[model samples]
Target: MALYITDECINCDVCEPECPNGAISQGEEYYRIDPNLCTECVGHFNTSQCVEVCPVDCILPDPDHRETKDQLQRKYLALSGQATAV
Candidate 1:
């Protein structure tokens, strides 16, 4: 599943650089994650880096954008330019 930053985010600026997909960005009030670009760090790391570094634990899976592990892998490959998104 894609991850999203919640209202609980403290904007500590830790999660931004941790995102390998560049999916995290500063929003008007807080940071936001672009679901289309978020692969939960599938191909980049064993675990989500943003989640690891987030001080407030505001990052959480997006229930609306549920995806399987294989789907996340495909997205990671596509994002890395190793393959085209199907």
Candidate 2:
């Protein structure tokens, strides 16, 4: 599943640079994750970098965007231009 930032986020900006997929970005008041770009770092890292570096522990799974490992891989491929989003 894609990871998302919660309202509890402090906007410390720690999570942004740690994301391998570049999915994390600054929002109006907090950091946000682009579900279409987030792969939980499957293709780039062994685990979610944002979650690892999140000081506020506000990052959590997006239940609405649940996806399997293979699906996450496909999403990574699609975003990186290895394949198209089908």
Candidate 3:
């Protein structure tokens, strides 16, 4: 599943740089995650980097964008411009 930043975000500027996909950005009120660019860190890390680094624990899975592991891997491949594994 893709992750999203909630209102609980403290704007500590911690999660933004930890995103390998460059999905996190400073929003008008707080930080935000671009769901399209978020693959739950599937191909890059074993766990979500942003969630690990977020002091406020404001990041959570986006219910509307739920995805399977294979789908996440595919998204990772697409974002990285790597050929999808067969």
Each prediction's TM-score against the native? 0.95, 0.92, 0.94
Runs in model 3 deviating more than 4 A are: 84-86
lDDT of 2: 0.90
Quote the lDDT for 73 in model 1.
99
Which digits, one per residue and each the tens of the lDDT, describe model 1 over residues 31-69? Answer: 999999999999999999999999899999999999999
Local lDDT at 1 for model 2: 88
Candidate number of the best TM-score: 1
For candidate 3, give the lDDT of residue 6.
94
Tens-digit per-residue lDDT, 5-79, candidate 3? 999988999898899999999999999999999999999999999999988888999999999999999999999
Which whole-number lDDT from 0 to 100 does residue 35 have in model 1? 98
lDDT of 2 by residue, 14-50 (tens): 9989988888889999889999889999999898988
In model 2, what are the clashing residue pairs, if there are any? none
By summed lDDT, the worst window of 10 consecutive residues in model 1 runs over 77-86
**Which pairs clash in the backbone of model 1?**
none
